[model samples]
Target: MNRRHLRWTVPAVTVFVASVVAIVLFTQVGGSAACAAGGSASYYSAGRNGMCNLGTPAEGLYAAVGRAEYAGGKACGTYLDVTGPNGTVRVQVVDLCPSCPAGKIDLGKGAFARIGALSAGIIPVTYGTTRDPQVGPLQVKLTGGTAYSALTAVLNNHGNPLSTVELQTPSGFAPMRQGEDNTWTAPSGAVTSPVTLRIADMYGHQATVAGLTLGPKDFQPTGTVLYGGPSPSPSDSPSPSTVESSAPSPAPVASAGPSSLPPAPKC
Candidate 1:
């Protein structure tokens, strides 16, 4: 072949290859950005606990619950299929963490689980939430006084209940039993100081409240004091019969000590 012709052929092939590579790179970048900016999803473990920050609200909301598993350089868990008012979506635990009050992942309701059974605390799960996780220290609340009382946490998904609750403390993670009044009470005295509560729905989604915090002072040791319950009814509103003029004996509210997990600062 002539020298000029050979040079032209080589340069033409190089340009074509470069163009293809650029197109592929652009597609990959766009996909990644969508996944990262996407709304909330959560990951949880049977025994591990830590926070999963889902960034801001602009991201959609979802929830998921399931046995946590590990996958290609990431954490994963499955949630019960969910069908929300919007539509159906399958969520995978992409980058979230299992916060205290284990077993539940944090996610917006939109991206986790099949919708119908989202209200149940524990349900068969097959999906999970995905997000870049942020793990923080620990927080605790003590209520009733370490005698033998139950513990509870009111989870709000942006001011709504998450349908499930987790009672966590330095001792261990205990699943709270749902009570008649939207309350979750665990077997007495299973938790102590340095407790933190995290919750997720059957669909593997976390509550959307501004914050959910649990501590030693949030539970009691002897009595069946309430931890979390329905919003409130004037009929049951702290009637003198249900409440006492003086605080319970033993650990007074004043002794909870300086909590490390201060109430999550105002949003």
Candidate 2:
């Protein structure tokens, strides 16, 4: 069942109650109209592996965000709809550009080419987190796991920035700690084989995914798509991203000065 119905044309919240697990939905927020600081956009050449370390988004549109916006790894895996001289393209945050200023962004070579002239090197642009994003089903892969022991999970294609991931235990929901790479980890005996995960996004929308076994070489689809709909045309005008407890994600407001900069991400 789809959790977030983007086409509702109104702020929505739906709970997919199930007899299999106790699912509690949090205060759901509306999606972002767009998230941007309105800055110059330049292209970068990485080894193709970004600081977030995700190789590349399947759709291929991706970018390296600056410190003020990255919010440590908080911005990782989130998708942004950027509008430039040519058009709007949705790109995932895959890398970090440490030298870039607060509002500036570094698009992947291909992404930059789509928005502006590559030879131009840089172009003015507006960008923000997208709504009703097009993504594949949620994928959960065990980075490291053993029967009833400690383990780590790499979550993928979870349309929105995740707020939390907890493993179900006999006692209750055992919270999983997010690692630097953005993977979630649980300590020894916190869970057993084929565990269930209670996942929540920043917007507070939650879902329960079960039957995740201890073994899987490739990412296994959970058969759950949080939500999707005709994305409202991303805002073309430059605007400071607006964020609320429950709203579409514009990148978090950037603070002033070098002190406002987040610790440089180790690429």
Candidate 3:
């Protein structure tokens, strides 16, 4: 064996891989995202209120993420399957714990008990989001909207962290900005009914929920799932809604990256 020849091989391969990652992070538009993180976990059972500002809880299992994972409400409504000493339990990002540091979650009492002992108060945990989780139809809570003010929607029932939320316009689909509470705020436009929304989750799944109506302060439900698993039974929905999946346009780029490349600018 030629030790001298093999000496540079491993380092060369490593450099190539790192360069490729740096290039992709700086250049690519959209790609699959993997959200694995090791962190400490604690339980919170007070307020039931969340930074999400969604009036009703999306589902039973939920948690409050720290500032790092919260990413300015990006983690809101996204389900996380956390594995602890007890087992793995899925939870929604219902709130934010500003005091909680990176890689930490203040899980709900019920959800925390499912994964860890209540007496422990806190425990080490690992958590991440899956690609195509079984999720219910889309629900939108429209509020802070009027003829004078543009409509704000706090979308619910997302299986993954949503990357893009847009509305159909005459010119094209106009993008909306996710507010601090995870509500996507509309641009300066008419908030008309029979509305059409184009959304993309982090896992590269895109779907259109058209023939949908958005009224001010309305918690409307649609018979649609973002992708994967199974469709909710007819009994689950009363609306005549349709969910159509289109070939995703370039998919949502995974914002996760190695702790290199100058660090992602905070949102």
lDDT of 3 by residue, 1-267 (tens): 110111111334334333321111111112333333455667764243467764323223567776766778887766566777788776656677777655567776766677777776666676654334455677776654457888677777665678899978788898989977778887875667777789987556678888766654555778876765443322311122222121011112133322332332221
Q: Please provide TM-scores, in order, for all candidate models, with all chains considered together.
A: 0.25, 0.68, 0.68
Q: Give the Cα-based TM-score of candidate 3 against the true structure.
A: 0.68
Superposed model 3: Cα runs more than 4 Å off: 1-37, 46-49, 55-60, 216-218, 230-267
Give me the displacement of residue 128 in model 3, in angstroms.
1.7
| C-alpha RMSD values across all candidates | 21.0, 16.6, 15.4
lDDT of 1 by residue, 1-267 (tens): 010100111234334333321110000110121111111223222111112121112122223222222222112221122223334443322223323122233443333233323343222222213121111111222344245666654221112113455665556655666532234566676544445555553223342221233343332222211122222222211111111111111110111112431221111
Model 1 regions more than 4 Å off:
1-145, 157-161, 207-267
Q: Can you write out model 2's per-residue Cα lDDT over 1-267, one digit (the tens) per residue? A: 111111112122122111113212111112222333355677665443466545564323667777656665667667777777798766777667776665567776667777787766666676665433555557777756565557887676665667788888888888888765666887666445777898877654577889888766556767875554433344542232321111122222222213432221221
The per-candidate count of clashes, in order, stands at: 60, 6, 2
Cand. 2 TM to true fold: 0.68
Q: Which of the predicted structures, 1 or 2, would earn the higher TM-score when compared with the native?
A: 2
How accurate locally is residue 175 in candidate 1, as Cα lDDT from 0 to 100?
67
